[model samples]
Target: MKLLFLACLSPKTGNYTTAERIRSHIESAGHSCELRDVADFHSPSDLAHLVSQNPPFEGALAIHLFKAGRLLLDLRLPFGVIFGGTDINEDVKDEQKRVVMEQVLLKARFAVAFTEKLKEEAEFVLVSPDSKIYVQPQGIQTEVAEQFCWTEFLRSSEWHSKNLHNILIIIGPKVDPALTAEVEAVVKRATGVFLAQERSQQELHAAMKRCYAVVNSSVSEGMSAAILEAMDLRVPVLARNIPGNAAVVKHGVTGLLFSSPQEFVHQSQRLLSDQELRERVVRSGKLYVEEHHSVKQERETYQRLVDKLHKAQFLA
Candidate 1:
């Protein structure tokens, strides 16, 4: 199938937007796929003239739904939409944003929501009680993820290894200060990396392999790349207790969930102090992600949707 992938890609940093991954996955399946970073347009960049008019794409997959790119909702092409965090978490709460989001939802041949919670939220936003929304987890190539030796990372003076463990926190400029500061008290004493920017996919997987645990502190999210990647590497996750985080991490089995920073630190330290408990959570987390977030599974679902959409369009 010929496909045109559309989304804004953030380069010069380890920002792997979901749209890029879907494009890569589709291409690997022997389907022709081309990616255009629409956000880079109107500014001088190496990839200028990104796309003034939509290319002749048989299938157009829009990863983000925003006013800047809302034209896709009205385009003639049979499009697929992949929901990002902002579209649901923040935008849907606003009247104008909700309307645009709903418009995009209705235009899609099928909607791809990374989490079940998001699928539900999108349904409410669209008010199409019967919208065809697919709850597919973002796939991860665990085998190819970079593996690193993290002895030094564990040996820092603040890294209390005696009765503590390293728990990695992943986020970027998108994280709010209030939430970060609130969780700081819980994480300040923990031996972990509090990164303003996430590591590259390779570096991230490598780091996950070395760490005892991963933390999700997002006050709001759709489905987190950090939590899923940590699962791929078999790292235990201690995620914030929210719809987005809850949809991914199975409480008590995959990881502990908390609403506050104090709770995050408390649960984290508890998980660290118990080896057997940690192992159990990691084991469950690994199997859970591999089963649901596998690349092949998502491809099959997408193919089916595309095929169905083609038939419906022909019938009309």
Candidate 2:
């Protein structure tokens, strides 16, 4: 089936990466998939024109509910909507977007949430008894180059001069002002903590390998690719103890979760001093990623969705 995969195709962003991975799986299954940037279309007519040219496209898969799925509303296509982090975390709180998202959810043949907690929250808001929300964690794979020099990376980062356990904070281009200030304060108040932002995926992976622990400071998330990548690379994680983060990082098990800046600072020290704790979490983290977020599992899930959608479209 020829399919349109609508998502924010910004390079290295979470939505783009997730859409790309799903698109790859669909294409690998011998289905033709067109990945279009949600940002590119201005209106339903713009999208309608694009789909018209393709002629007889089976369906579409939209990445974010309120953002990307909004445009697909009038397309009259049997589409599936995938929830991005901010959609369930922030947009559901906005009255206007929340109303539109509920309509989108109603129209969607099925919707996806990264965790069961996220699905529960979405279900509460949509209040649909027969909602087709599914929990599917992101598929992840990690590999550090054989010649990756941790010491050299530290020296270049100027983190080597400070005798501290370097912590990498993964951030994107446009961060919330409040979140930015909070992360900055954490870096300043803590002596050894360092910020590693604005790096390429490969660069970030190398940094993840060298850093003592990776930190996720986001107030909201669907499922953090960075956290998964860190776990895949056997790096211990310190993340905000929100439902999404908690869903992935089990406190003192897979990784450490902190409620406040004070807790984060305290845990940072613990992560540095407690060798046994660090080793156990790192080992458990690797195992968790291997078992939960495998490429094979992700591919199979998408394949099943594709088949399901095709069958639905054929019957319709």
Candidate 3:
């Protein structure tokens, strides 16, 4: 079967990485899968033109429900959805987007969420009994470039400080220019806080491998691919105490969680000073990733789902 996969293929973002992984999984199952960046299409007519120009795709899949699913509505092709964090957590707050998302869910053959909590959130939007949502955690795999020089990376980013032992890197979405400048100014005043600019996946993994700890301070998440990747790379994580982060980081066990700025400071101090605790968390965190977020398992799950989708499409 030929499949069409739509996603926001922005470089260095989680959605692009997830779409790539799933596309590989589908192709590995002996199917032809073509991935297209949804950013290229302005409307359903654009997608319709592509479909008409090429051989018809037997099935379709998308990462974000509202962003990508809206384009699938008029295609009249069997398609599934994978939840992008902001669509359920942030975008649904708008009544118009929520209504459109509801229609997309009702029309979709199936949907996928990264965590059970996210799946439950999706269920609330998809109240119809026939709507099926699967809970599939993001898979973890890390490859650190051997020649990646930590000192060179720091220098390139304009951090000339020789004291690199306790460097704390902040990784998050890009904000407005004014807000970003304000944040960068504050970070510059601090001793060792490094604000990461956009980097390729290989560079990001190398940076994660070298950092003292990976910190996630996002206001919301579906399930953080960064946290999982950090754990997989055997780096201790300090994440915000949100449901999505909490679902992965068992406080003081796998990693540390902070609800407030003071808590984050306290936890960071504890993680740095207490060598035993740091070692224990790093060990356990890597183990958890190996067991729960292995690439093999994620691929198998998608392959099974694709087969099921094929069967359903055949019967219909």
* TM agreement with the true structure for every prediction: 0.79, 0.88, 0.91
Q: Which residue pairs clash in candidate 3?
A: none
**Roughly what TM-score does model 2 have, to 2 decimal places?**
0.88
The collision pairs in model 2 are none
Which segments of model 2 are wrong by more than 4 Å?
129-131, 146-197
- Determine which window of 10 residues in candidate 3 has minimal summed lDDT: 151-160
Residue pairs with colliding backbones in model 1 are none
How many angstroms is residue 95 displaced in model 3 relative to the true structure, after the best TM-score fit? 1.3
The alpha-carbon lDDT assigned to residue 110 of candidate 3 equals 84
Give candidate 3 misplaced runs (Cα > 4 Å): 152-163, 171-182
Q: Write the per-residue lDDT of candidate 3 for residues 44-108, one digit (tens) a residue.
A: 88998677656777788988889999999988678888888888788889989988888888888
- Each model's Cα RMSD: 4.7, 3.2, 2.7
Model 2, position 259, has a per-residue lDDT of 89
Relative to the true structure, candidate 1 reaches a TM of: 0.79
The better candidate by TM-score, 2 or 3, is 3
How close to the true structure is residue 160 of candidate 3, measured as C-alpha lDDT?
39
